[model samples]
Target: MPTLLVTASPHRDEALGNRLARQIAARKGGDLLVRDLAAEPLPPLTVDYARALTLRDPLPRSNATLELSERLIEELESTDRLIIATPMHNFGMPAALKLWVDYVLRIHRTFAPTPQGKVGLLAARPTLVIVSSGGFHRAGESKQPNFLTPHLEAVLSTLGIRAPEFVYLEGLVGRRATPEAMIAEAVAVLGDAWY
Candidate 1:
């Protein structure tokens, strides 16, 4: 069976997106993996980090962090599907999730440089991202999406994953859209075929 990994922070206590992610995992018929970035905690990318990763040498830091990074990558490589339940924090993703991305996108691992251009090392896979926000900000409406949608797409594309399907649940606090309504929308959108 394939696996679905949902990375996010549950600080808001909003399980709508997370519940939808679980449904997707069930549809995929895989071992569901949920890694709360806030709980697991990934460090920010740094110069030493790049050096250590490129050289395949251990960094003079917490071994646990490095091991978690390795484990995350291994899980990604093995999984057939991925679902990202992300909440927009200050118009972008939480810092923890960004750190998780940094850890997985290693040089010569998730991607490699080619003579023509950078080539993706990961196999093409299906990814469903459920993004929740408190306001409406479509592509042309906002500038901050660059750090959220495009960043994920670029990294996933670099790893050979393409055509990611993202479900945007906007205006949860306003527009009279309660958490229940948002969750219902997500669940309906994810349907049985999504995974």
Candidate 2:
């Protein structure tokens, strides 16, 4: 089964959920692919990119940027298990996540253009999202905790994926907590998932 770990943080070595996913993959005898969006940034959608989209049978132009975008989408379509580890920013996801979404959710690949309505091309799969933030956001508590989780859920659901399992590490600041403690909490919250 294919597994994907999409992360936003610039520092690849510091994500707690990434570390957890690695350990689980090692034990399970599988490969873990971490697509660091920060390292490989997609260009802001341009006229050329739009033109390529309109073509019935498009060919990659000299820029080679469209080729990279297609490769990224292919990887997402193949992955059976997915993990998105992100640090909540401004009560939402970082730009890296948004960029990845822009690439993978392309037409004629991840979705189909239908006369009735938009249809998801992906099969239902399991996804785990681990969110870390300095503040707290409870379902029925905390007036101004964060808006990241809801947005993530909606996007993933639209892609024909199962409801994502969420692990939120809140109050990371001034908690006097160790990284181990935080990871253990995450494991507890998510249980023995695909990791």
User: How much RMSD separates candidate 1 from the native structure?
Assistant: 3.3
Pairs that clash in candidate 1: none
Off by over 4 Å in 2: 54-63, 113-116, 140-145
* Residue 170 error, candidate 1, Å: 0.6
Q: List the residue pairs that clash in candidate 2.
A: none
The clash count of every prediction, one per candidate, is 0, 0
lDDT of 2 by residue, 5-113 (tens): 8877665657665666666556556566778777776678766666777778665666465667788867777778888878888889888888777776777767777
Highest TM-score: which candidate?
2
The C-alpha RMSD of each candidate to the native structure, in angstroms, is 3.3, 2.7
- Model 2: number of backbone collisions: 0
Measured against the true structure, the TM-scores of the candidates, in listed sequence, are 0.81, 0.84
Q: Which tens-of-lDDT digit does each residue in 1-195 have in candidate 1?
A: 576566585653345566667756775675776677756676666666666776766577765546766888888887887788887787677787878878887777778988987788888777888887767678665534435787778878887889888887776655566666766776666645583
